[model samples]
Structure formats: structure tokens, C-alpha cells
Target: MSNYSIPYHDIDILIPSQKFEVNFSYTSSQMPNFIDSMIMRLLRISPLSVKNIAKFLGMNQRESRIVLDQLITNNEVELQQDGLFHLTNKSMKYFTTVDSIPKVASILEHTHSLIYELTNFNYIAQKPDNNMYGIKLIATSTHAANSENIVRDRFQKQFYQLIEEDIITLKKIEGRPSIYKMGTVKKVKECTVRKSLDLHVDAQAEPQAIKVLDSIMSDELKDKTYQALGQSKKGNNIRDILNNLDGFEQLKLNQYFKDGRFLAPNALFDSINPIESKSSDGNHLFIGPCYSQSNSKIILNKIKESIAKNHQVSSIYWLAPDDVFWGKSLRFNTFINALGQIKTKQNTDLQLKCFLPMHDEQDRTSVNNYRKIIAKDQQKYFYGIKDGILDGNFELIVVKNEFAVIVLHVLDSEAEYLTSFPFGSISYDKQLVNGLVSLFEAWERPKDDGGISFGQMFKKHSQS
Candidate 1:
């Protein structure tokens, strides 16, 4: 438990749950601008040497040191010793009072600014019964002269993250001394103090990078001419990360939690083909074009039953090859709107049901990131996403392609809708493609033999 600077009153400053990532980069979450997160962390655990800080960051020593120096230059942190640093007196004083400021934010303005002001006034946070947070001042210093006013001013001057990570606005109350009514959201309070998104799905998840040199040379990542993806300078480093991927059958990444907030661009994701072990039975699912968008319940139910049959189905998993969580995504407006409408507690339940590990949860996009990207608010498409990715928890295999499908193998048993092999797309391989068709042909039987889809083919195989 954290010792909050201000009196929480009835507010509970709980940490939001999320999937922890080892290295959440600026490229991933554009808000909170690494600088802001580091500064805040420094202030909370101040008076540390630059070398110590660098060592703490290890692989990020250089970047961390540079940012630390920048903080001093910016007057956010003061250099006290050879390598030691502390928050500037001004910052200390401001933060001290940040605990109890009014949190009523303008839905039209920067949400981060409101959060900053509220923190300055001595409040960690408070939300309405819906769990969609409203403003609640916890007051560290009840008499700091128009505490709310000062906080508001300071926040107006600083930078802010515009994502929906830690944010809420105040609604007026007719009779309460400080009634910050909420919208229809009820989220458990969990503030990690640090600003970043680390999504670790399973407890034993580990970090692994692959060098994608071959991929860089391929048509998937780069342009038609096959030139590197801009960062020719980043060369082999990116390649190394890609190569390591060959060892694993799947990959997962996390998004960011907004710090305050900012505006950014929308991005997209792409899926590669011939992914092995995509399904639970440790079998490979063809990678082509998945019609998952058009067919929902049918696919979901099949996957659900498939998993339940064998590998002890647990959950679902879904991932876009690449994505930008903002207005640009195909599902952005829908996802945000839905999240906004639901109560925070309900949102929490949704997170568990869907298994959105990156932060124990996810919600609407309040603003665009600096990159100008937005999430494809269509969470409906991603519901039970994790399970879908796992191949029905270890039973059947469904892959998508541009034209047709290639049913690799059906486990020992037959799944309901799954009995109809090759539901969606097929792999993009010549030899493999022909091989699959041959296998399917061999499994066919005579129509009179029973009335299965291909009885003639099955009879031929029986005779053989």
C-alpha cells in the first residue's frame, strides 16, 4: 500500500490491474512522455545518483541518463551531488499540495491537466458509484490559499497524457459539500505511480526478441521495392528480434495507459502466415486472411467447444499484428463508446472475461496520441479474443486466407460446427497447400456410405 500525501477522505487510490511488460517503450504509448514518468518516479524516490539510476535501468542506461539530465535542465529535478538528484523545491512544494486539489476536469480540455491539478491539491482519486471516476479532493494542506485554483493553474502549465488510463471528470451535485458525481463507470483504483504499459498475460510470460532481417528483406514489413522500414540505421537490431521469434509459435505485445493524456495518430496491425501451434492442441493454424470479422458467434462457439473438449480450455486471446489505439482504428468509436457507457466494476468484469492482461483492463480512448493514431474502438470484434487465438483451447484449428482454407488435422474427436473442416482461410504455401487438399481428399467417403459432406472420398480411403 502507498502512503498517499493527502487525506484520501473516502477515496480509495487503488492500482489499476494490467499485464506488466518488461520494456514498455515510447513508440508503444506516446503519452506521459517518458520524461514525465521518470520525473515523477524520481520525486517519489529522489536523491539518487545518475549512475545508480542508470544501473537501475540497465539496458536503458543511456536513455535514462539523458532524460535525467534533461529533467535537471528543465528544473523538474535538481542536481544535489556528483550524481544524486532530487525534485526541485518548486516541484516538491507543488506536489505536496497536489493531493487535495479539485478534480472536476473539462471534458473538452486536457484530461491530464485535470489530473495534475487534482493531484497537486492533495487527492489521489475518487470515482462515482459507477466507478467511472469523478473528482474528489483529498487535501494535503486544507489552507494553501484557493488550493483548487493553484492546482488548476499549475496543471495548465505542464504537459499531460490524454489516454484513458487514469482519468475522470466531476459532475455537479445539488446538496453535497463536494459531490463529484460520476458517469456510468466503476473502476477499481490502482495507480502504479509509474507511467507505462507492461502486459504480461500468463504468470510465466517472458520477454524474447527476434531479429527480423529476413522479414525486413521480405515484402511483409517494407515497401514493394523491399527497402528497409525507414530505420535502415536500426538494421540488424530489429532483425535480431525477428529471428528469435522463429523459436516461438506466437507473439504478444501490450499498449499504454494514458498519463493525463495527449493526441496521437492511428496505426494498423498485420498477421504473418503459416503460424505453427496457434491452436491449443499444439497444432498449427493456417495463416492467411481470417474472415473473423464477418463470422463471429459461429467461430467463437466452435472455438469454445473445441477448447472445452480437450486441452482444458481456459481463456481466449486476440492480437492485431500492429495497432494504434485511437479514433483511427476500425473499432475505435465503438470500443470507446462501449467502455464509456459501462460502469467501472462492469468494465473490470469485462477485462477478466476477455483477459485483457496489459493493465488488468482497457477502456475508451479519450484523445489521440501525438502520433495521431487511435484504437479501432470495435472491442466487440475482440471479445473472447484470447480463446480464439488459442485454437479453441486445444481442439480444432481454424485459419483464414484470401481464397479458401486447408484443414490440417482434427484431433481424435469431432467438434460440432468444427466437424466441417477448413472453416476459413488457408495457408499461403504451394507444397503445403497441395498437401492439405490431398489429405482432405483421402478422408472423403461415398455419399451412400453415410451422408457425410464427402462420403465418396471417405469410401475411397476406406477401400485403400
Candidate 2:
């Protein structure tokens, strides 16, 4: 987790794989030896005494007898009642009758470990680490695509390939090795990797989340994941985090949440900037691929322009839970200053409703963080976002009947060199503006007036 600096959430999933104990049999040959080789070759052709074997090989009977005695000890030869040395069954299998130069060959069996993904029958690097925690178990149906026969076939096909790649370290491979037998295929756990979209304020642009290595999520598993998340009680909690999200943000969620969690995708910022467009109802849309340097300057100018044109203004401003409220960007303070000045000196009838997500009502850190962002005297104008949504990454500004801007947020509090801002879209159309107002209205003032005043929240925390 320390390696990745991007503000991201992750859901651990267990990918199914099989650990195969493969028994491989191959013919092995020892280093060359003339005396032992000739003696065995002679005995293999016909039963021969020490004198006959020595005579055929042009060697002394004494030396040949010593070697044959050693061969008998090794189970390669035996002396029969007929007084002749005979090739043992083990020795018979070791040499071909037609070969003149004898080479001792023995069938040897060795067990090797191999693992493959059960979902696709592809090779995995190694066995899973059992010490790791929080990995969600995948259903058995996720691996129903590959049968045991298919897994064995894939292992057989890749066996030589693995050796060529030096993944298999068997040095002495005899001619045309094969699987003598296979151990029972057992299911084991593997983990999906975590990748994040990082913010580099000094670099050209923040890098998007990259594709994870060896994603075991197949199409079937992904469908099951989507269905699971949609039905889970915890998934309903994620819905709270998504409240008032724009269409583009919603689409990103639908595309990336295939892991059955509220995890942002690697290409979270890959969405193309829609420069301008018209709504179905004929409203003009102005969009900006906002630069991190200015921090939503285009949208701020729009807000200022709207402020200049209107005297009595009604607006709703929603801030992301963490980054904006902590003053990571100076622009937030700047916006507050400009609006505060107008309300104080210009004496405009301005009604501004602001919302922030507070994780707990009595959390001292939340109360203090809110105080750091808005002045104690101005806390009355803000409301705490309700429900169980813990964090969000977008900001909304809706000036009723004037314009609305949805700005993607920068979540890294420690990032100094902000490269690129997510995006911002503004609309001046009356219907669009009214729709945004209604959206915020429902969120801020529900049927039971679910809104909790920031002033009261802070006071209660202070007392507690």
C-alpha cells in the first residue's frame, strides 16, 4: 500500500488456481565408462563368464571379474547356476541391443510443482500466500469453464515452454519426457493486484491507473461480481457515496466497479473532455478539461460571472469530504473569500447552501476540519452530508437558474505538483440549472429534512 500514493480504494478477490503435483519420468544416462559399458553390453547380448567378457573386450579376467562383481551389487547383472553372468531386468531396460557403444540409461521419476488459473487454465507464477488476509473467496462456478482434462492439457502443452523460459530447472531432460502420473488437483488462492491513479503535481499529468498484471477476473466472474455488489447490503452503502454524481462519473463507476467494490478504475481519468454540447432539451453545455495549475479557474470565472449578473442569488456548493475541506488547494479559500466579500459589503440577498460529508456526528477531527475550511461565524450556511458514504471525488456548484458546474476533484492532499485536473462541465440552460438545483434540493432537504446543520454538528462535538 505504501508503494502506491494515489487516493484509491481496493477490494481483495480470490482467484481460483490449481496446484499440480506432476510426476515426470525421463531416461537418465551416467558419464561414459569403457570397461563397465563393454561388460554390460557383452552380458546383454549373451550369458558370459568373466573370462568370456574379458576376452571379448580385450581385458584381463581379474579386472573384468572385479567390475562384474560391482555390476551385480548394483542390480545390473547376476550370476546364474550355469556359471555365466546375465544381464538383470534393470540392465536390459537400460541399453538397446543394436547399439555398440553402451550407455547406461535408467527411468527415473521426479515430482514438480505447477499451478494454473482454474478460470482460464493459464499458468500462474507460484502458490498463493496463505498469510495474506481480507481476500474475498470466488464462487466455484467461476472456475467451471475449465475441467480437469483441460487443465492437464494446458499443463502438458506449456511444460516444454516453461523449461525453455528457464522457469523449469530440470537440467537433464531425457528423450520425450512425459507425465507418469498427476497428483490430485486441489484449489488454491491467488490475489488480484492493486493499481492506482497517482497524482504528480510537478509532472506533465497524473498517471492513470494501469492494467493489473494477470487479472483472473473472467467475463462470468465479472457478471457475478456486478450482481453481487448490486444486491449486497454494503453495496447500498456505496450508493450513498454516489449521490448527486454526474452522468459521466456514474458511467465510470459502472465500467470500473466490475470487481464488486467501489474501487476506481485504472483509467479513471480517460474520459474525453466534452468541449461543448446540447442537451436533449436544447441547453448549451460548456465543458473544460481543467488544468491543475489554475484549479478550476474556468468554473470559478463562471461563478463570478453569474454572481456579477445576479443580485439575489440562490446556490448549492458541495465539497468533497477530505481534500477540499483540508485546504489542499488555495482556490477553495479564494472562492469563499470572493463570495464572503459579496455577501458582506455588496449586501446582495445571497442564499448559499453548502454540504460536506462528515463520517461521524461526534468526530472531533471532522468538526475541527470543518472549522478549518469555513469560519466559525459562517458555519450556519453549511449542512453535513448524510447516509453512509465515506468518501467522494467530485464537487458540484449550482447557482439556481443561472449555471451549474461539476468539477472532478483532486484527492491527494500531499501532492505538490498537480499535473491535470479531472474535468468540469458547466451549463447555462434553464432546465439543466433547475435540474441540478432539484438534485441538490433532494440531497440537502429530504422528506424528513435529513439535512444536519454544520453549526449544530460542530456545537455538539464541542460539547461532547
Candidate 3:
């Protein structure tokens, strides 16, 4: 949510593309022709007149003449001055001399299936299994204009290559062979495909689909999306058509930020005035060195475990501030790095609200980059940052109705805040937990309500 928000409207349009099934006829070498090969074999042994060839082959001279004429046209034989026929050099090409005897090849026709999506003329691999992939089929008789010609031309261009790649296998096409000619190409059936448009707009910018988020959509897909919108009779404008679509579902940008179960305050707890309570029992409390890298890592792991696997995290509230110099403290950086793991939990609807007060101007770049890490997913990760001062350095984390962590400097001294480690405790005590929750709610309330309204602060920063 680092981008500016003038706030107009945005949407995602999922369109099921139309597909047409088509079949085409092509020619390829199948097997050898008996009569054609026999004639060539006889000529290879010795030159023979058509009469002699017809006599040896048990055919009348008329039939033999027709056969010889075809052979001559194919350049397999030639009539010489001696009035006899001889095998031409071109005739040897068809012979499979790789083995002892040369074998001749012949051609046969084949019918194969090719699918063409009407939205984009590109031939698809096969019918997609998902219904959302493509829905309606265009009738063969009434399809997009010029689609037939385009499909035919593309099939022609890819025909030979398809055979070479075994997609359209030919038994034998040894010498350079060409498609004798194209045959009937017609749509046979229909198919389905899933396509979508990610559109956004506001008061300051014109309405348009945000292409950056949709790297999977090809240029052709974009064209089809627009074409579909343009041809729709439902509405005059894109927004109108989108809204008018049947079964349309509006996706809200603030869905993740909405207060769910975690933000539902209890009247009884709200009625009780919050008071700080300290526990001495070892089992209910933990005392540790804050600057200890190992201790910080253990805490990070605890946070990860609370949100992972079977855990269903409703929300998270973290109160951590920047150092006076620039960027975050080493311990804070350790926690920031761990946020990557927390930000990307697919199974959980985790909402994290962190308050990072920027104390120095140099902290801007580092903090912004840190924000960018989770802001990419604006739905779940929420944050608030502003230049301010606090009494002391501390780190606090609370998982709604789960657990609370409070780390604070035990002694108010520069050395303790610098090189020396602070003291902290992890507690699940009900009173202590309620107190922290109260503090968080107070800080999160709206500015008009005498609170910072950290939720709106994050939302504004995200859109800004």
C-alpha cells in the first residue's frame, strides 16, 4: 500500500474464453505402391519398351502406357532415342539403398484434430479440463470473422513442423516432401478456458487493467478481454459491463484489514480499568537477555509456530520502534527478517499490525524497504510509522487471545540501552494479557476518538 490512492474503483473480471474444435486433412508417405515400384525395378535391370513392360507385368499396352506416362511425369523414368524407357537419376532417390534392395515410398491422407481458442487464434495443446478454462463454443457456421482463414493458414505453416516434432507423425517422409494440398478445415466442437482482467481506477487516473500483476496473461489474452467487453450489449462503459455481469463477485481492498474475531472487544473486559501486573512465578513468566541473538531467534521461532500449521491466527499486534541513529536495532532487524516467514503463510488469514516509529530522517529508506517486504501483499500486512520519541527502547508482541511478549530495558542507562542487554519476560497470564490488549486498542483507536487509529494509519500509508 505504498502507492497513492485517489480512490475511484477497481475490479477483476474473470471471463471464460470460447474455444472451437477443428479437424484438418493432410497427406504423408504411408507405404510403397506395388505397380509403381515394379516398373522402376524392371527399368533398373534393363531398359524396356512399354509393350515389353506391359507383357512382363501381365498388363495390356494401353494400361502400361498410362502407368509409364505417370512414371514419366513423376520423373522416375524417361523415354530415350532408342525408343526404350530408362530409370532417371531422380528415381533412385525413392530407393532405400541403405539396406541391400531399394524400396519405394507412397503417399496417403490423414485426418487430425487441432483446437483453436476463438479469443486467441493460437492452437492449443488439448482441451483444458477445468470448466472455467473455457466455457462456450462458437458454432462452426457462425464464428468470429476471418477465423477460418487464420486457422487454416496457421495449420498450414505448422503442419510440417508438427510432423517433424511427432505431434503429427508421418510413417516416412525421407526426401523433402510437401503437403500435396490442404483439405477441408472446419470447426467441429466447443471448449472452455479461464481468463481474467485486473482493473483499477480512481479520481486522478483513467480506468484500466493493471497488467503488471498479471504476467501470466499474454497480449492476445488482453486483446480478447477488451474485445469481449467492447462487444457486450450489457453496458456502454467498461465499469457498467463489469458490474452488470451475472454472478460477479466484488473483491475489496480492505478485506484483510476488516476487524474480525480478534478485534471483537468484550464488554466485560472493556469495563475493567487496565492495570499493570507483574508475576514472580517461574512457570508463568520468563526472564531473558534481550540483546542475546540466540534468545531473539528462539522468540522468532515461537512466533512462527503460533501462526503455522494447525494455528489459525486471527490477528497480530506488534509495537516496535526504530533506533535514534537510523534503520532498526539488530534485535529489531532480526524480528523484521522473521516477518518474511510470517507474511507468507498461505493457510492462515494472518493480519499483522506493527507500529514502527521513525526517529531519524536516515531511517526512511531502510524502513520503507522493510515495509515493501510485506506491503506487496497489502491485504494482510498492516503497518504504521511516524517520527516520535518514547521513554525507552522496547519490543512488544501480542497474538490475540494467544500469548504476549514484553521486552524492556530494566535499568535506565545509555550503556544498558547500547551494548548491555535488556530484561524481558514472556507471559500468558490473563491479567497481564488483558492489560496489553487494552494498551493496543487504545493506540489503535481513531484520531477523532482521541486515539491514533493505527488501523486507518496503515490503510492510508498503504494507499499513499
Candidate 4:
């Protein structure tokens, strides 16, 4: 362990004389051990001979000698040339010298006040490597008289400052039990700076969710859509038509204008630009709106690429809204068709584990089709929102241990035209994909109606 010590006299100079009125007394039983209390109290006034200590404490000389000899053996106390007993330097590190009675008294007073304010508190001594060092206050009862923040601030800034300069190092606070460790502000500052730099690098390296939105709303894509509209209908201009549409309808029309495969009035020029593909060694993610059939086809194609390369897809986890599986939805049709192709190529049934919102009237046909495609040996798990499991509207698709895609649904009108697009901000970041996989593994659900058994699925697929 690292040692941090300062002369008691230096601390004494910082304490006020008026605060000396408070008493700092300890009953014998309050000491950690009987031998410690006896030795501390005896050495506080002045060093003493073993015979003198034994006589004062009413013990035999031999018994006293044995105890004092043990203290010497443990390096807790030292014997001077005059044969007098005194505390070792190690012991002195914790307690102020007897000459600094006023400083000790002031500490006791603050401690008493803090204890009175807190209805309950706990202290956990941290290891040497821990960032925090020394006494740390975590929580106090709501009914307590003192404001927790105010009291902690005052104690940390004022009371601790006067005692020792090194004490200022212990400042990191966490929830529940308080943590204390030996650390300096310089070390903490360095750690913060390092973490900030790492985050900056991560942000720059990965494609952010916002970038997908930017691509979809680019002026170039908009201009292409406007031109396509003009060619399809004579004398119908972009401004006149856009003026009559709501924000959502305008975005939906813009997407359709780019990919004429979904709507009527086909365009001469193809506006649906493809994302630059990367090596499939690691996880890949794609994020963007998915309202059009063309976009759904793109997503389905990515999944086919993964399944085709591996021959057999070990497991598939999906989190999506109930509407995504509606019979009328292009996404539903595309997903179902893709599953059929995969099953035929592998000569085995497709296995899908889905977390979807509660079943609605529109989902009946799609859900029935889904059950028919899944393998007989492999079970299909469907988790409902009423179970209080899912947290967001974002769609997630993970293909075994290989890759995952997360597309956040755009719901509000703040993005105006962008809201009309089915989704926003897509990320194919490998780190994020792995984190989602772990999150799915750790999530809890009810025992009875959760879904097909997670254990059986894990045993079968985890090995792959």
C-alpha cells in the first residue's frame, strides 16, 4: 500500500482555536483492540516504562512485558534507548499527536455533526489501485435535517482540507455504499482526459446515425426526385405538388421518386444510391428510413449475402414493431420471401427469434406465414411488448455471431420531411452490434409466458 503522511503540527496550524472547545474522548471499548487502546492512551501523555505501564493499568509486570514485546514484534510500537514505550511511525499516520488536541477535537465535532445528519451510511475501504481514497459519503435519509449535497460539499472542501493536503485526493463519489481510496486530483484529471480522447476517436472512426439522415435528406437526392416527378407528369412542377403535401407525405414521395420500383410514374434515372460495401469479416450495420419496397429489398439482400456465404445461419434475433409483419407491408413480404429462399438453399427450415409488439389484427396473416416457414426442430419465439420487455421503437436484426443491424424509427415531426421516411440514423458499427448482442443475452423476462425457452436456443446455437 502507498503511504501518505503529513506532519501533525502542519494540520494544527490550520485548525481554529475556537473549535478547540469540542471534546475528543474515546472509551476503552471503542478502540479496535484492548492492547491498542492501552498503548495509545499510555503513549499519548508521554512514553512509559513497561513496569510503569503494568502498574498503572493494574496488570502483572510479566503480562505487560509480553504484550509490549508483541507490539514491538508487529512494528506497531517502538522501544526507546531509555526503555520507554511509544507508538511506531505507522500508527502515528492515523492519529494526530497528543500535542494537537485541538485539531483532533475539531475532527470529532464535524464527524458527530455528519453522523447526526445521516440516518444511515456505510464506508467501504477500497484497494490501493482504486481512484478514490479516504472517507466518502454516499447517501442520507430524506428525512435527515441536513441537505446531503451541502453537507458533503462543506465537509469535503473545508473539514478535509484543514487536516492534510493529501486528503483532497479522495473525491470520486458513487451510488449505494460510499468508496474511499488514496488518489490525487492530478490522476483523476488524467483519466478523464484519456477517456475523452478515446471517445473522440470512436466517433470519428464509425459512421454516426446522423450521417444516414443527412444522406437521405441531401439536396442532390431531392433534386433528382423533383426531376423524376416532372418527367412523369407534364406541367406538374415540384413546388406546386410539394405545397399540397404534409411533411410526412413529402418525404414519402421523395423516397418513391428516387426508387420508382415502389410507386407508379417510373423515373428514367435511378436515384437510389447504394452504400459502399465493406469486407464481411466483421459485423456490418446499415441505418436509414425503410418506408419503400426498394429499401426493404436492400436490407433483405444484406441478410442473404451473410447467409449465402455461411451456408447455414445459426440464429436470428429480431426486434421490430407489429406493423413490420403486416401482410400489406413491403418489408413483411420481402422478409418472408428472403426466409423462403434461405430455407430452400440450405435444405433446412429457417429459425427466427423475434421480439415484437403485441399482435394486432393486421399481423395475423404475416404471423401465420412466419410460423409455417420456421424449422420443425427449431422453435419460433415471439416476445410481446405487454411483457414490459422492449424499450424502444428501433428495429434490430442480429445474424448469429456474425453481424447486426439497428435502425431507429423516426417518429416526431421535428425532422419534418425526414419523419415521413420510415426510419432514421442507421449504424453498422461492430462494437455497437456486439453490445446489443450482449444486452439481448442479459435481458430478463417472465418465467411462464416469456417465449420459447432461451436455454434450449442457447444450447443449440451458442456453440455455432
Winner by lDDT? 2
| Error in Å for residue 418 of model 3 | 47
Cα displacement (angstroms), candidate 3, residue 331, comes to 36
Candidate 2 local lDDT, residue 188: 36
Q: Return the lDDT, model 2, position 356.
A: 67
Q: Report lDDT (CA) for all predictions.
A: 0.27, 0.50, 0.48, 0.37
lDDT of 4: 0.37
- Candidate 3 is scored at a TM of 0.33
> Which candidate number has the best TM-score?
2
Off by over 4 Å in 3: 1-25, 29-105, 133-150, 164-166, 195-220, 226-464
Better of 2 and 3 by TM-score: 2
For residue 20, give model 2's deviation from the true position in Å.
Answer: 6.1
Where does candidate 1 have its weakest 10-residue lDDT segment?
261-270
Which residue pairs does candidate 3 place in steric collision? 1-462, 3-464, 96-103, 133-192, 133-193, 133-194, 134-192, 134-193, 135-192, 445-453
Query: Per-residue lDDT for 356-448 in model 4, tens only?
Result: 454332344433443432333333355333322323344566665555654433232221121112332233455655666665655434347
Candidate 4 Cα misplacement greater than 4 A, ranges: 1-292, 322-331, 344-346, 359-381, 385-391, 414-420, 424-430, 444-464
Give the residue spans of candidate 1 off by over 4 A. Answer: 1-238, 246-301, 306-314, 317-367, 370-464
* Cα-lDDT of candidate 1: 0.27
